[model samples]
Target: IGIFMWVSSTEASWQDFRKPCIAVVDAKTPTTRIIRAVSVVLLPFLVGFLGYNSMKPSTDEPIELRTVHPAPPASTKVHGKTFVLQTASNPYRVDDSGKYSDKVQNDYKDGNPWDEKAPQFLQYVREGGQIFFQNCHFCHGDNLNGRGMFAFAFNPIPANFTDAGTIAQLQETFVFWRVSKGGIGLPREGFPWASVMPPWEQHLTIDEIWKVILFEYWHTGYYPRTWD
Candidate 1:
């Protein structure tokens, strides 16, 4: 299949080329012979040194010294309102009694979000789900497990909510702060601004942010730890 125009004079200058090679090996003087011997000995060493250095591992990528979940600032300003992380709460996480308390939200855990008579908690969760699918789900995932289609596209990747080390360990207020401010609002510990999580306060209302937190907790069935 290799179509090449080959001439019949295959031996045309093959002998002529060998004449130079014979001259090198035809070392009549001791200095010439010594040079030939040294070349032979140094050639393999030079090749080996080059190959070893070329195959060595490179330290090209910069090391990341960022803190994923650095301690949140005690208070953060969102939509021109300052919220103290320790005291802030998700106002939408309420039951029929209209307030979040011990196991009250669990009553509406199986409630139907589509029903007109659906409990307030479920309705808020539904609204949050809508907002999440519209804006947040691309990176946070449909299941909120941080496996969304565009999850790994970011440097640190999205948070896996199903993991105990993430949402389960943090307070809802902390999540509120994070949602409202996003990665850009993170303290100096989250250096280099590698996180692409957009500050939601710019795009969503504070209530919408709270509802999203409710939906996340409800979907994962993980109670957000309280500072108390």
Candidate 2:
């Protein structure tokens, strides 16, 4: 009697477990048979449709990417003098009217700190390099390439001293005026000056400014303009 009871309970549990699976496809019931048949036919078609859609290429147009070129520098005249753009479109005119213009021009023409192999000239270049790294490197970069740490903060970006469009075409007097007066010295009649370059007259000695200029030309292998 005990064995018979245990076998009866086991059969009942098996029937309970199989009840759901049997109901899923009860062939005698028309509704269950229809659902099972529809699922068997439609599942493969649905999967195939999805797979086909996934494999198909997109019909959208390709995107075009054009290079963004910087605008050319504008030309302007200041106080009966013509000033052209140099180094990131900054307008600079030679200091032909200043007291020390001739002196600065003369020193530039001498060209010792760059072309000379003499010990004193080399020493001058060395001193200029020291000054540049100390004061100017933060904005102009160690390579004088103008891509300094703070360069991205400015719109037009810092002057690329290595570019031929910059120091290559400029006169030494131009350099002198820009360095001594900084942004405030820019003529009001010219393009709106918005640079943060401070007046170095209060900060750097005149001699130190000159030395840095020499170092710039020497380091970059660029020569100052011989003409106006």
Candidate 3:
């Protein structure tokens, strides 16, 4: 009777539970359905997000914040007839007459003993030419004709040293003064323009200045007579 009951129960359970459907559904159909669902859900978001980023306008980053404080106004005072200052970049102009004092011109003279001999003068010219070529050639032409490469860029243009009249009129002391003090200390009517001629007095020895003076004189045919 027990064996019979057990068999009946087993049969009941088997009838209640159907066998698993092992019959393979078309794999392509389910795969396509899953792929379609994922595509439908994800494609619009991916495309829209990428498109939005691409369409957004570019913006510059903010500049660094800063504070600026300008320097105080410069002080001025007259010393004797001229003004002295902490910064010599621009000296005080004395008169409105556009003339600098002779005191300033006298300041440039070195009082070197002049040699009259041609060989000595020639030697001075050669040395002066070398120095001028090394230092001044960038602004003054190689032949001293004032056609240097830098002359083109100058607003007032460099003086034409080759002009006989101009060369003859220029004093050696005047040349030395211009070289020593530069355009800043020059009379308003003299240089009358800005320049890059540095204060060569600090860099060149007194003898070198005389040599350059002699060289310029010789180059412009003022030498032998002017050397002394």
Candidate 4:
């Protein structure tokens, strides 16, 4: 009880001692007096500035929470042709049955793509593989998982088709627009960005582009989402 009283009394004495007394301030020089006056006026603004900076979000964080499949335009033009995204479909996403065949697509994943007897869909997949290996492998890697030989050179590297966020969630037509337009494909009015992806339209034909997309789905076993 005595110890508690002593500590309380001591703390009260310290608080009394710390109380500001205007007469106690030693502004002996003109400069010292000016500095004190300026500090009195500027301290609140300085504190406010620091507090605001501390509370605000950073401009660059390396991590971005972005829509992997952003809303695509209703109609997009590429290579002297316009594709209506809502109605468009992947022509190569078919087998000998004349439509998508789950069994055929699954079997081709393990089988040789370069074989002479490869089914029609598999044949397109083979050609797509050729295009990917020739152009995309350096950045997307041989596995089409985005870790290519040249992948290390880029800050973000290429898109990993294996990830559910990328190819799996996107429509084939949307994918087509991205490839054809590359970095310039992003919505112009929404935000500003500069992508390193080359617009494939300048180099590859529409047929080649479709074939590359076909190979990607076959290799990954992902079907593009259909527009309802």
lDDT of 4 by residue, 90-189 (tens): 7777778778544556666677778899778888989999998998889888888889988878656678999888898878889998888887677876
Put down candidate 3 lDDT per residue, 41-137, tens digits, no spaces: 6777899989999999879544443211112123322222222222322111112233433232222223232345323334455677778888787
In candidate 1, what are the lDDT values of residues 1-228, reduced to their tens digit?
Answer: 222223223565556656555766887778768777767788888999999999999978677865656778889888888888887777887767787674756776777777888877789888988888999999999999999999887767798898888898988888898888888787774577567788899999988898888889888888888777
Off by over 4 Å in 4: 1-67, 97-104
TM-score of each model, in listed order: 0.73, 0.49, 0.43, 0.68
Write the candidate numbers in order of decreasing TM-score: 1, 4, 2, 3
Q: How well does candidate 2 score on lDDT at residue 189?
A: 52
A best-first ranking of the candidates according to their lDDT comes to 1, 4, 2, 3
Q: Tell me, what's the RMSD of every candidate?
A: 12.3, 16.4, 22.1, 8.4
Candidate 4: the clashing residue pairs are 141-148
Q: Of the pair 1 and 3, which is ahead by lDDT? A: 1
The better candidate by TM-score, 2 or 4, is: 4
- What's the CA error at residue 78 for candidate 2, in Å? 19
Residue-level lDDT tens digits of model 2 in 1-228: 775566457778667766755876676688778777777778888999999999999997555432122232244333334445342221111233323232343344445544445345555667788888889888889899988898888756678899888877776546756776676666655535556677776678767877788778777877676543
